[model samples]
Target: MLLTLVLLAAVLAISYLLFVSYYPSFGGDVPEALQTKYASSENYKNGAFINQKDVPEDLGFWETLKIARKFFFTKVPNGVPAENIAVQHLDSIQIADYEGESRLVWFGHSAFLLQTKGKNILIDPMFGEVPAPHPMLGGKRFSKELPIEVEKLPKIDAVIISHDHYDHLDYESILKLKDKVGHFYMPLAVGVHLKAWGVEEGRITELDWWQQATLGDLEFICTPAQHFSGRKLNNRQSTLWSSWVIRSASESIFFSGDSGYGPHFKEIGEKYGPFEFAMMECGQYNESWPDIHMFPEETVQAGVDVRAKAVMPIHWGAFKLALHSWTDPIERAKKKAEALNIPLVAPKIGQAIEINSLLKPNSLWWENL
Candidate 1:
C-alpha cells in the first residue's frame, strides 16, 4: 500500500509540472508608473473590464463539470481526418495585380490572409496541430498541413489578432512565425500573453475599443464585440475582446471575431458602413453561452447590421468545438442568407475569393467529411 501511494503521488506531481510548463500564466504585473497614471480613470475601469451580460443560464456549474469530465475521458468523435480537407494549389495570389483592389484567402477556421496596397496581413493565425495547451486535450486541425508553412510564407507586413482564445491565437504558430512577422496588433491585455510567449515588447501593439492605428497605407480600428476572454478560470474578463475594421485607400473590410448578437454591430455599421467584405463568426454556438457566440441565423443578421456588401462565413468546418453536427452552422447559415438575400460566400479550405466577383455555390463539402 505504501509503495502504491508513492507511485500515485509521483505521477500527480509530474502531471502538475507539465501543466504549468505548457500553460504559462501571466497578467499580475504591469508597469507600476503606467498603472498609477491610468488605474483610477473611468475609462481604465469600465473600458478595460468590460463586463459580459446575458450569459445563458442553461448550464450550471455541476452540468459544466459533468460535460468537461466526459470530454476528457470519452473518445473524441473523429469527424474528418486531415487527409480529407481539400486544398487548392496556387503558385501565388497577387492582390496588387488585381487592379489595385483587396482580396482574401481563408486558411481555415478564423485565419485569413488579406492583401491590400502591396502589403500582406495575417489575421488570427492558428496553424498549429491542436487548439489546446496539450495536444491530447484539444480537437485536431482539419488540414494535413497549412496551405503555406510558416517559413514558406511571404514577408508578412502586419499580423492582427482578435483575441487570445486558443483556436485564434496558437502558441506554436506564433513561436514559429515570430521572427518573420514585422508587427503584431491585438486587444489591450493580450500583449501579456504574447510577452509570455517570447514576443518582443517593441513588436507588439495593443489597442482598446475605438482606438485606431496606422500600418503602412492601411488603418486598423478596434471595434466592439460581445464576448469574454480568459485562458484560465480565475482571470475571466481580465482582457478586452473586439472586432476589427481594416480600411485602405480604396477598400474596407470588417473581421468580426467571435461574438454574440448585440447592438454593437448596428453601431459599427452606422460608423463604418457599406464594407466591401465582412468575415463573420458562424460556429461553435451553444445555448449555454448564447451571449458569447452567435447562432447561425444571428451571424447573417450581424452581416446585415454591418452593412457588408458580401459575407464570408468563418469559425466553422475546422474543429468540432461544440456538440452540434459538424455541418449545422453552414447549413443553417445558407438557408438564412438566402432568405435574407445576403450575399454569402462559402469557399472550400484554402480557396481564394475575389471581392468584386460573384460568389459561386460549391457542393456541400462537409457532407463527406
Candidate 2:
C-alpha cells in the first residue's frame, strides 16, 4: 500500500510539472533586470507588486473552499441571460474608414475600441470565448459574437492593458493582435508576458503609476488602482495593476480597470477631472472579497469621485464572474447614479458611443435580454 501511494504521488507531481512547463498560456517569468527596475517603485514589495492599501487575507482555508464550492456548484438566479446577448456587427471597412470625432465601441466587459485623432486604440481586448487560461476551467462568454472579430480589426494604433489577469490580458488575443498593433502601453512588468508571447520589445512600453506616454495627439496616463494581478496560481501580485486616463486636446476619458472603491478615484479626478466620459467597473463583486472588486453602488460613487460628465457601467455584460444576478450590477448602479444625479450611459453590448457628443446611450437594453 505504501509503494502504491508513492507511485500515485510521483505520477501527480510529474503531471503538474509537465503542465506548467508546456502550457504557453501560463506566460513567462519576469527577468532579474525587470525585477531590479520594479524594486524602485513604492508599490513593489520584496518581489511582487502590491495594492495601494493591502487587501486583508482573512478568509480561512475551509471558508475559502466553501466559497469556491458555492461559486462552481451553486446556481444563482439570472446569473446568465436566458438568451445569448446580441451584438451589433461591424466590418473592417467601418472601423478602418472612421474620420469623425473621438468615439468608442463597447465589446462588452472591459474590452473597447477607442477611435480618436485618426488613430484606433484597443483597451483590454480579451476576445476569447472563455476568460480562463484553459476552457475547462471556466464558462463561455455570455455573448457569442463581438462587434468585430479580432482577425477583422483594422490596423491598431496601440493597445492598453490594465493588468496581467486572464480576463484582461489574454494570451491568444495578444498573439492575434500583436501584428496589427503598433505599440502597447501597460503597467510595470506586464511586458514580460508579451515578450514571452513573441511581441517585439520595441513595440511595448511599461510605465509605473503616474507615468505618461503619448501617441500622436493623445496622451495616455497610467494611474493607480486598488487591485492585484496574476495570470497563474503562484504569480499573484507579480505585476502591477492600474487604471488609465486617455486625454486629447478636446476631451478626456477614464477606464477603471477592475478596481475596488478607494480614494484613488478622487485623486485621479483632482489630477484630471471633468472627463467627457468614464467606464467604471461594476460587476463580479461580493462581500467575500470587497477589496478587489467594487459593488455596484460603489461603482456609481467612483464615477462621481472621478467627476465624469457621464458614466457607463462596464465589466458586467460579458461574463458571470460573481454570484449575483448578471443584471444586478446595472440595476443597482442605475439606481445609485439616479439618486446621485449622475448621467448614466448604459449602452448595449456592441453599441458605438460618440464620446464628444452630449447625447448618450441610456436605454434599458439589458431588460430585453
Candidate 3:
C-alpha cells in the first residue's frame, strides 16, 4: 500500500510538471481592444465569453485531494479501438481532375482535405497518434490511421487552422507538415503558437474576423464563431476563435471550426449563404459549457444557417471529448436533419465524398464500431 501511494504521488508530480512545461497560462492582462469590447459587449452579462463572476474559487488542498481521488477511482469506459472503426481508402481522389467543381475527404474529426478549383487545401490536420500536448498522455486517436500519410499527400497549397486548441492544431502533425505546406492561415494571435512550433513567419498568415485572403482561385474568409480559445488555463480568449468560408468561382464550403448555437451562425449564413457543402462541428458538447460546443441539433441548425446544400457532421466519432455515448452525436444529428428536411451525409472515416453527388449510398460504417 505504501509503494502504491508513492507511485501515485510520483505520477501526479510528473503530470503536473509536464502540464506546467507545455501548457502556457493566460499571459498578462487582456488586450485593450478586447477589454473595451468585453466591457461593451452583452456576452459578458449573459456569460457568453468570459464569465469572471462564474469562475470557480480555488479549491483547498484537501478538497483537491478528494476530487482527484474520486476522478482516479471512477471507472470511465474505454474508447473504442481504432481498428474497430471502419475506414476507406481510394487509389486517388483525383481532385485536380475535377475542374469547376468541389470535392472533400473527411479525415475524421475537424480534419478535412478539400479540393476545389484545382488546388488542394488541408483544414485543421490533427493526424497524430493523440490530440494531447504529448502523444503518450492524451486519449486515443479515433481512426486507425490516415488513408494517406502526411508524406504521401500531394503538394498542399494551403493549411487553414481555426484556433490554437490541441485537437485543432497538433504539434507533431504541424512539424511533420511544415515543410510541405505553401501557406498557413489562421485566426489572429494563433500565429504566435505556430511560430513557437517552428513554422516560418513568411508562410503564416493571420487574419481578423471577416478577413479574406486568396490562394490561386480559392478565397478563404475567416468568420466569427461563438467559441473560446486557449491552450492553457490562463490563456483563455487570448487568441480569437473563428470558422472559415472557403470559396472559389464555382464552389463554396464552410468549415465551422468549433462553435455553439449562437446568432453568429445565422449572420454567417446571411453573408455567405448557399454553400455547396458544410463541414460543421457536431460533437463533444455538454450543458456545463454550452457556450463553447454545439449540441447535435445545433449542428443541424448551423448547417441550415450556412445555407448548406449538403452537410457532413464532424468533431464526433473520432474523439470522445464529452461524456455522451460515442454514437450519440451522429444519431441525434441524423434525426434533427431529417426532421428539418436538411440534406445530410455520414461518410466513414477517411471516406472520399464527391460534393456534386453527396447523396450516393454509403455504408453505415460507424454502426458496428
Candidate 4:
C-alpha cells in the first residue's frame, strides 16, 4: 500500500508539471539576455521584480488553510449578481469614425477604450469570458454580451498593459487584438509574453517604473503600484507591475492598475497632477491580504492623494473575485466619496464620457440589480 501511494503521488506531480508546461495560456518567460538587461533596473532584484515597499507574496500555511476553509465553506450573500448584468451596447461606426475630444468607454472591469487626440487606445483590455486561462477554471463574466465584440473594434493606436496577470493580460484577448493594434506598451519583461504570443518585437516597447514614452501628442508614463505579479506558480514577480499616467495637451488621466494604498499615489500626484480624471481600482479585496489590494475607503483616499478632479471606481462590477457582496465596492466607494466631497462617476458599462466635459455624478444603476 505504501509503494502504491508513492507511485500515485509521483504520477500526479509529473502530470501537474506537464500541464503547466504545455499550456499556452501560462505565457512565456524572459530570456537570459532580457534578464541581464533588466538587472540594471532598481526594481529588479536578484532575479525577479520587487515593489518599492516589501509586500508579502504568499500567505502562511495556517492562514492558507484558514482562508481555504472559509472560501469553500463560508458563503457570502450576493457574492455574484442574481442575473446576467445588462450592457449598453456600443456602435462600431461611431468608434471607427470618432474625431471628437478625448473620451473613454469602460468595458465593465479594468478595461477601457480611450479616444484621445483622435487616437484609440486600449488599457488593460481583458475581454475574455473568464479571467482565468481556461473557462472551466473560473466564473463567467457578469454580462452576457460585451459592450462591443473584440472583432468589431477599430484599428488600435496602442494597448497599455499594467502587468502580466491572467485577469489583466488575457491570452485570448491579445490574440484577437494583435492584428488591430499597432503597438504594445508594458512594464519590463512583459514583452517576452507578447513576443511569445506572436507580436513583433519592433511593435513592443517595455519600460520600468518612472519611465516615460511618447506616441504622437500623448505621453505615457509607467508609474509605481504596490502589487506582485505572476500567472503561474513558479513565475511570481518575474515581471514588474505598475499604474499608468496618460496625458495629452488638454487632458490628463491616471489608471490605478490593481494597486494597494501606498505613498506612490502622493508621489505620482506631485509629479503628474492634478489629473482631470482617474480610474481607481476598488475591488476583490480581503482583510487577509491588505497590502496588495485596496479597500473601498483606501480607493477613495488614493484618488484624493493623486489630486484627481474626479474619480471612477473600477476593477469591480464585472467578475466576482472576492468574498464581498457584488455591490460592496461601488457602494463603499460612493459613501466615501460623498464624505470627502469628491465627484464619483459610476457610468454603466459601455457609456462614453467625454474627458474635457464636466463629469456629472452617475445614477445608482447597480442598486436595483
Candidate 5:
C-alpha cells in the first residue's frame, strides 16, 4: 500500500509540473526589475499590491475547497449556451484605412474595440475559445466566434490590460495579436508576461493607478479597481488591477475593467464626470465573492456613480465564470437600468455604436436564448 501511494503521488506531481510548463494561460512571472519598480508605487506594499479599502481576504481552506467543489460538481441550468451567440462581422479594409469616426464595437465580455480620433484601440482582447492556459483545465468560453477575426482586424494602436486574470488577459490571443499591435498600455508589471510571450519590451507601457498616458488626442488614465491580480496560483496580487478613463477633447469614456461595488466609483465620477458613455462590469458575481464582483443592481448604481450619460453592460455574455444562469446578468441589469431610469444599452456581440450620439441598442437579445 505504501509503495502504491508513493507511486501515485509522484505521478500527480509530475503531471502538474508538465501542465504548468506548457499551458499558455499560466503566463510569465513578474521579474525582479519590474517588482522593484512596482514597489515605489503607493499601491504596492509588503511585497503585494494593496486594495484602497479593506476587503475580505481569507476564505479558509475548508470553505474554499467546498466552494470549489460546488463550482465544479453543481450545475447551473444553461450555464452554457445551447447555441453559439450571434456576432456581427466587419470588413478589414474599412477598419485599416479609415477616417476619424468615433465608434465602439463590442466583442463580448470585457473585450471591445474603439475607433476615434484616427486611432484604433482594443481593450482586453480575449478571442480564444478557452479562458484557461490549456484545453483540459477549468476554462471554457461561451462563444467560439468573435465579431471579427483577430488577423482580419486592423493594427491596434493600444491594447489596454486591466489585470493578469486568465479571462481578461488571454495567452493565445496575445500571441496571435503581438505582431499586429503598435503599443500596449497596462497596469504596472503586467508587461512581464507580454515580454515572455514574444512581444517587444518597447511596445508596452505600464502605469500605476491614476497615471495617464496619451495616444494621439486621447488621454488614457489607469484608475483603481477593487480587485486582485495574479496569473498563477502562487503569485496573487503581484500585479495591479484598474479601471480606465479614455478621454478626448470633446468626449470622455470609462471602462470598468472588473470591480465590485465600491466608493472608487464615486471618486472616479468626481474626477471625470459627465462621461459620454461608460462600460460597466455586470457579470461573474456571487454572494460567496461579493467584494470582487458587483451584483447587477450595483452595476447600474456604478453607472450613476460614474456620472455617465449612457451605460453599456459588459463582463457577461462571453464566459461562464460564475454560477448564475447564463442570461441572468443581462436580465437583471436591464431591469435595474430601467428602474433607475438610466440610459442603458446592451448591444449584441459585435454590434457597433456611434459613441457621440449615444443611442443604445435597447433590447434584451439574450431573453430568447
Candidate 6:
C-alpha cells in the first residue's frame, strides 16, 4: 500500500509540473539572448536573478509539505471579504472633472493609475479576474467593479510593471492595455513576456536596479525591492524585481512595488526623499514567508524609512490573497500609523489622491461591511 501511494504521488507531481509547463497563461520565459545579455549583471548569475540579501528561495520540501497539509486540510474562513468591497468607482471619461497637478486612482490590489503633469502612467495594472493563470483556479476579483475598464482609460503615457508575478503582470490586462499604452517599463528581462504578448520590443524598456529612464520631462528610477520573481517553475529569478522612484520637474513619488522590510527603504529615503507621497505594500503576508511580504506595521515603518511625508497603504482591500481577515491590513496599519504619527491614507478604490492637496484621511471604511 505504501509503495503504491509513493508511486501515485510521484505521478501526480510530474503531471502537475507538465501542466504548468504547457500553460500559455503562465507567460513566456526569459529568452536565451536576453539572459546572455544580462549575464554580466550582478543580480543575474548562474542563469537566474539573485536577491541582494540572502533569503531562502522557499520552504524546503518537508516544510512545504507541512504547510501544504495545513493549507489544504484546514479551512480558512477569514480569507475573504465579508461582502462585495465598497469602492468609489470612477468614470475615466470625466478625469478632467477632478482638479490636481497629480492624480492617482487605485484599482484594488496593486494596480493604480497616476496622472501627473499631463501624463497618464499606470502601475501594475492587473485588472484580470484572478491573480493566477486561470480565473477558475485562482478564484475571482473581490470587487465586482473596477475604477475604469482598460478600453475606457485615456492614452497611457507609460505602463510600469513591478515584476512578472501573475498578480502584477496579468496576461489579459496586458493584452487590453498594450495598444493604448505608449511605452512599457519593467525589471530586467521581463520584456521577454511582454514581447511574446505582442507588445513591440521598441515600446518596452527593461531596467536593472538603480537604472534610470526618461519619458519627456519625467525621470523613472528603478529602485531595489526586497522581492523575487518568476512566472513558472523553471524560470525562477530569471527576471529582476524592483520598486520605482518617479520624479517630475516639481514633484517626486516613491512606489514600494511589492517589497518586504529592508534597509533599502532607508537608503532610498536618504537618496531621493523626502517624497511628496509614498505607496507602501501592506498585505498578502504570512509569518512563514516573512522575507517576501511586509506586515502592516512594517509597511508603516517602511513609509517612515522612506521619509514619505504622506503614505498610502496598498496591496490589500482588493483580493483575498492571504489568510488574514480582509480588513486586517488597513485596520492594523492604521493603528501603527497612529502610534508612529506617520500620515497614512487609505483612499477607496477608484478614489483619487490629489497629491497637490493635503493627504486624504483614513476612513476605517472597511468596518462598515
Enumerate residue pairs that collide in model 3. 26-234, 26-235
Compose the digit string of candidate 3's lDDT tens values, residues 152-267: 77778899999878888887788788888999998776777777777788998877778899998889999888777776645666666789999877788899998878777888
- For candidate 4, the per-residue lDDT at 73 reads 70
Q: Count the clashes in each prediction.
A: 0, 0, 2, 0, 1, 1
Rank candidates by lDDT, best first.
Answer: 4, 2, 5, 6, 1, 3
Task: Say which prediction, candidate 3 or candidate 6, comes out ahead on TM-score.
Answer: 6
Per-residue C-alpha lDDT of model 6 across residues 1-369, encoded as one tens digit per residue: 999999999999998888777866777777688778999888877888877788536766799788757655566666676678767867766763444578788898889898887788999999998888877867677788787777888788899989999989999999899888999998898898888788899999999888999999999999989888888767778789999999987999999998889999999999999899999999989887888899999999999999999888899877767777777888898889999998888887887888877455546667757
Q: CA shift at 293, candidate 1, in angstroms?
A: 0.5
Better of 1 and 3 by TM-score: 1
| Worst ten in a row by lDDT for model 5 | 356-365
Report residue 104 deviation for candidate 1 (angstroms): 0.9
Better of 3 and 4 by lDDT: 4
Best by TM-score: 4
In the predicted model 5, the residue pairs found to clash are 25-133
Model 2: how far is 144 from its true place, Å? 1.1
Q: Give the TM-score of candidate 2.
A: 0.96
Prediction 1 global C-alpha lDDT: 0.77
TM-score of 3: 0.82
RMSD of each: 3.7, 1.7, 5.2, 1.4, 1.7, 2.1
TM-score against native, each model = 0.86, 0.96, 0.82, 0.97, 0.95, 0.94
* Stretches of candidate 6 exceeding 4 Å from the true structure: 1-18, 96-99
**Against the true structure, candidate 5 has what lDDT?**
0.87
Residue 254's lDDT within candidate 3 is 91
Pairs in clash, predicted candidate 1: none
Best by lDDT: 4
